[model samples]
Target: MAFHKNLTRVERARLAVTKLICPITRDALRVIPLTDFIFGIYISSRYRYVYIDNPKTGCTSLKSAMAELELRGRKSDLDPLNLEVIHYDSSPLKSFVPIFPKPTLSNLIKNNYRFVTFVRNPYQRLLSCYLNKFDNSTAKDNPQARRMPRGAAPGSFSEFIDAIIGQTDHDMDPHWRSQSINIHYSRVPYAYIGRFENYATDYVTTFHKLGIPADEIPTLRHLNKTGAGRASLHEFYDKKSQDAVYARYQDDFVNFGYPYELPD
Candidate 1:
């Protein structure tokens, strides 16, 4: 579909080969996950901006806002709240690998593109992931949840932490994956790394970095909020769960500068 169109020629060719060999390999040689990782990286040549999406870290709002800028005040078919539309090929912001050849992308990365991403506190991010993806209301419909091993109780936050402790970032869903891994911090030279904790102000800085005029910067909207009421981290986290999450995403805390202890 349009989503698959985001695959570069090389990626498409790789996928084709993987498809043929996957059956023989009992689907052990899957490339779809890697392709999905690439899909999280959106680029706009017109704006000279590259946004690496960190799921559950204000990505929907950021992408939607950027799409608005890319569309140049025109109405967009992509909705911030609609995951399918915002992420698909029809969106104004294009995936980097698919839109530019490797050499061109390398040049742009080295000399032009302003790469930016937002990261949330690991504790909050994991809680949000569970509330959105593993809750009884959502888990049955979520593909990632289905693929996950059945151990965590439908809405048990601590169990959810237990369920994914050993999984590598490559195999884990981006929503709960380490923020540093999601953004490939070691590999990508980020021009700005905003914190989800300071979303309102940080996004304005991001829009300015993208060269969006102050008057033209779209109002940031909160999209894909999980559950109703204020779900505090303390309610779901205890010494064990907090320590487990810290161990799992310690790199995120270190790389993103979030404190190890939960904030009051």
Candidate 2:
């Protein structure tokens, strides 16, 4: 047992001593340099950290904030010395599997970086994903396209609800929150959490707690900017379709605190 190097004193000395022989690795380490002290101290100071992104959430804004911190040297963004950020887009499981045994989260927690994530209402998320995939020419031509709109049909929201509710294990990307919930049946201990409706307040409050300056918090960017208003959408959904959709996303509705009012 490597004696859990992140926590133990002996392991720290071993890593430090080992670095002297590995000069190439040592030089590389300088850029994102992490000695045992910095790693241990960082983990101790932070509250908690976990960015559970589930597409549709305002991830770009969060990424920008993190980039700023990295530039300042107050934190590192994939620094050769410290690969603190875990990006799912590029570093897929196959590439990262061999390094799984290493203490990854231990360093983040030690460094005072808090875990965070945002979730959108399932109904709206399904709608956005469906449109982004089929209605758009870019996705319509792609082989990986999951659900293409039928014929000259406009891909009604009703159809979107049916596709999601009527399938099992259908989503290609195994969502982080869903998998975590399935495995643990507990909400992840996020230092901050945000929902689509209240993202502005949540975003500012969360980073403020993390010591980000009030003036620096980025404005919330709505990805689905152009739309007929929620009231119009509410009028568009019929009672039967609404009921079915609610039944489909009951888990998300409950867990994420979305209100579902059956049409009168």
Off by over 4 Å in 2: 1-48, 72-99, 104-113, 147-154, 170-187, 216-231, 262-264
TM-scores of the models, in the order given: 0.81, 0.57
Clashes of 2: 14
- Per-residue alpha-carbon lDDT of candidate 1 for residues 67-155, written as tens digits (9 for 90 to 100): 76777656656654456657766667764453222323345576678889998888888887777776735334566675356733444
* lDDT of predicted model 2: 0.45
In order, candidate lDDTs are 0.70, 0.45
- lDDT top scorer: 1
Give the Å error, residue 255, model 2: 1.8
Q: Counting only residues 3 or more apart in sequence or on different chains, how many pairs clash (N, Cα, C under 3 Å) in candidate 1?
A: 0
- The TM-score that candidate 1 achieves is 0.81
